[model samples]
Target: MNFLALLLILKIGLSLALLVRPFMMAPTKALNNVMSLYGDNPLIYRLYSIAILSLCVAYGFGLYEALSGRMPWNVIAFGIVSNAGAALALTALNSHPKLRPFEATFATIAAALVLCALAPNYALMSI
Candidate 1:
């Protein structure tokens, strides 16, 4: 598939993983690692996941439109802003070496998503 479609699918999958991570990690040490950073409360994480999942649905629609040769500028803008913001926010967590691996992985993913969102426009400009 196209680049935008691929990025959107990857993002949707990542968001789905986030939506289930709290529950999936509950019986594992991974949960403890998260708890140490956030808190003892998994509720907050679950809530955040719900929000992300909702956005993922919206992104699905955006992807459909994009594949039809009509780029959804609004969705692209939102993706750029949200992903860039997430990447920036994760950078702050880097100070805690214990969280570096987790933060860096997602931050890198977010940054990639931001770049993906901008890439089409960049290509258009060069044409």
Candidate 2:
């Protein structure tokens, strides 16, 4: 209904999609093979997906609470990590220009969500 809700929807949708990317997009031609080399068995990749999914859920709940303009510590931490990842991706994708937008969008979305969460009307004081 408000800016924070809208941002949460974006974060939730994008994150959920990303978390499922490997499984759904893997065998399909449209799915880029760049990630295939990592294979399906790496315990690390599985852990990574779980973490990403958890972050998404956090964003969803965090933004839900953001209606009061109080950004919780968990949400702030998530934003910091998301922002850091975006910066790293932007740098890492330098050799692959096709990925430029992905990095840029992640940075923008996460930053906006962070700002919206910290706004006066949507904040939570007690963490």
Kindly list the per-residue Cα lDDT of model 1 for residues 47-121, writing each as its tens digit.
676678778888899878766666667777777677667656767544655555656555665665566556765
Per-candidate TM-scores read 0.69, 0.66
The lDDT of model 1 is 0.64
As a whole number from 0 to 100, the lDDT of residue 100 in candidate 2 is 62
Candidate 1 RMSD to the correct structure: 4.0
Model 2 ranges off by over 4 Å: 23-32, 36-42, 67-70, 122-127
Write model 2 residue lDDT over 1-127, tens digit each, in one string: 5666566677778767765556333443333344434343555555666777777777777776665555555776767678668768666745466556667777887677566556635533323
In candidate 1, residue 23 scores what lDDT? 48
Q: Candidate 2: how large is its RMSD?
A: 4.7
TM-score of predicted structure 2: 0.66
